[model samples]
Target: MGSLHPAEKPKAIDLSHHLNNLSRSRHPSPLKDILKYMVQPGMISLAGGLPHPSLFPFESLHTRAYAPDSNLAPGETKHGVVDIHIPQTSASTSNIAIALQYGPGTGCSPNLVSFLREFTARVMQPAYADYEILIHSGNTDGWNKIVNLLCEFGDYILVEAHTYPSAQALWAPMGCKGAPIAMDGDGLLVEDLRRVLANWETDHPGVRRPKLLYVVPVGQNPTGSTMTFERKQAVYALCVEYDIIICEDDPYYFLQLPAYAPPASRKQESQQDEQALLASLVPSFLNLDYQGRVIRLETFSKTLGPGNRLGYFVCNPIFAERLLRATEVTTQTPSGWSQAILAELLSAWGQSGYLTWLRNLRDSYAIRRDWMCDLLAERFDLENSPVPTEGVLAFAKGHGSRADRKQLFSFVQPKAGMFLWLKLNLIGNPEYERLRAAAGPNVEAQWNEAFWMQMIEAKVLLTPGSYYTPWEGRDPSPNRRKEEGVTYFRLTFAFESHEEMRLGIDRMARTFELSWNLVA
Candidate 1:
């Protein structure tokens, strides 16, 4: 597909018309008007029922350096740690006074907010002129806020066929329905999106057309598929054509891994070449969004740590201001202590230093990815090379000979993020075929349950593909169940140690071998 020109970009959706009743009724907090002055040089604020900073007992706060030189691996340079101390004084910017006291509902400390704005401007270079930023707790909170802000009850949310389960769980409870868009190896398939939107009324008779699209464009949660630049352009074009709002929840944007290299070949590549590869990452949706329709959710969860609960949203001022209003009534703000600590850390690191830290983080995860991939390759009978096929498991299912039944498993070695999405060869399982033949109402669930049980018995656990399946209650056919039958398991190499990763794969391979009766 050709690149979309400024004139060619779709018209922006009117966000005001899409907002729910509660969101539409929401007005700015009166206390926020007064709280804005609390930071002024001589302002004595008795507004907002804020707690007195003097009443707090603690005089200071301290913490050890996070990841000091002592913790560095051999030959690795030390990324400076964040040793912090916040005095009780109100005079100092890095003090506990403002942090301990009630502040703006926007979750982030003023300094942290400034830092993130600069960071976003420098890195993302969003094309929209009216874009604004709002701090939130994390992507999870961000997703919920967006759902509440945009979706009315019974509204359809378009998502990649394989998507973040937690996001679905949040939307499902709100009476929102998921409309699953088909995906290729690159993530959400544009053609499927076009087809679904074009035929919405006929295919989904009486159901509302989806106005919102939720996607994890970088290292998509369970699938670990990164949308290519061309694919993203096509997707954006479709979203414009369909008049859909895009919610880009990308927590793993910076954790993108370098292109995979075989174990033997990696040793041959020079360090310069590897660094060059790392620098060439795919552009974010925010970068490509010309119309102010894309709202991006970014987080420090994957990079800094989830415990911080710090993230922010980037969107046009219209949506951002509304999201801030949502925050005022809900979380009120993210933990002040987290924002304060992160502010100090970011100020110390600066932009270049921060980029270095991200590089170190990406390199570390890449090592883990390589370790896990190598173990899976050794333990499972698999195809190492990418096969030319459409959708997941195209290579194995399409080209395999009758004798190739012994090749029982395949995976798209992730180019980014922590997950390796394993497509199990359930077609070779005698029980699976039997269950398919019977085709009872609960047969698909039973097959998945049995398969899950076997894996648990083997002492390895993985997220079932069904958890990521979009629930379309309106569909009358049995095709959804059949689609769920294409067995997939998401494995993460993030938390596990090198040895533990090896052990997990060993157990997974043993379970597959036993189930398929392919033991040598």
Candidate 2:
């Protein structure tokens, strides 16, 4: 576990080969380029479609904001108000006049960008010095840009066997195919990645090797798997070897939680400092990206609010310039209102406050994580055990064929993010094969759909794991693919109260019991 502190300046690597024809043909906006002259001393600007702030309908914007440490357990949440009054005239980036006007595609303005760049430098400590940031709508928007930058029609993109479905869906419509790499409880399996990359020509014949890899390294969307530092090192090495650009779509990086233990075995708490907090997190890919191939998609959606629709790319300045060109054409900027509010709010919080806010969020999510797992364990008679992978814990119901067994489900307790990836022993249900054959070619999915509908009938809604499958992954856990007789469902502990969670889990358990005919 080496420190992520910067050891060297980043060296430029030519990744232009990875760019698609469409992106290569793009040029920066001519009008946006002219804004450079608009800032000169007392220049009368008639350059762009500039709306005079005087004609703007609103005089100011105001909202009550949350405190940095809001929502801590056993304490009342504190709040504050951010007021942006559009003064008659002011040149400050944080002023309401500038906030309400046209903004750069880099962000709505330099206000949020400056705050974020400082925060990234201080907290994330990207190992590369030449890295740049470009704000987009969020991870979804950020991902779309990456796909456009690299993936041409019919290009294959590497992805974890299970990934954020939307990321896969974004490129699938472009006629590109998904090259799924195997994964486990610790996220991407390096050997499996190497296996795919090393054997690409043998497998695909004339198809080009995938030039881009999309992964959710923290609290994997469907699987709730977190990558360890060693795992990231290995993955990064493979990307470098294979000459692939890594699109690290890590919205949940700050949601990293401590290992779960049953209440009886749970340890007491200790005071956590900023350094300790940073140390606890698995370093971002940017930390290991000396050659600048990693485009780490950082977002304020999870950290702040999703409605803000703001996120940014941290990568080599070369790739960033191309992405900036793309942005200059499409989503020229995020909502100006969003950037201003966030800029004000974050400035109020400062870097220390931001970390404190993140700490509070991490703790809150961890509590909910505990609540979900604890309820499941209580209802299922689960046996908790340490999995072979680092940062992974699992729960399993009895595997025996005893007639008294009522239901069966297995899951990996999440180490980060909002999901609990669970596998119900649908094979434990008597009609497994009947349902399997009924679905024909799409057996796993249709079979899982039957179970999902059963849960819906029972008034509990959990996402079918099939939705998150990058390809046709038989099992959510790559290590357990050989072990069949199970179907996957993804549940989130991020929303709803403890009582609601319990009620849902109870209903889920009862549904399984009835399906197994263990209930009269």
User: 40-153 in candidate 1: lDDT tens per residue?
Assistant: 898876656877778888788887555422222324666555777778874545678877777787753778888888887667767665577788898898999999898988
Candidate lDDT scores, in order, read 0.75, 0.79
- In terms of lDDT, the poorest run of 10 residues in model 2 is 472-481
* Model 1 quality (TM-score): 0.89
Per-residue lDDT of candidate 2, residues 305-363 (tens digit): 89999889988877899999999889887887787778878887788888988988898
Candidate 1 worst ten-residue window by lDDT: 389-398
lDDT of 1 at 494: 85
Candidate 2 ranges with C-alpha deviation above 4 Å = 1-7, 74-76, 79-89, 385-407, 436-441, 471-484
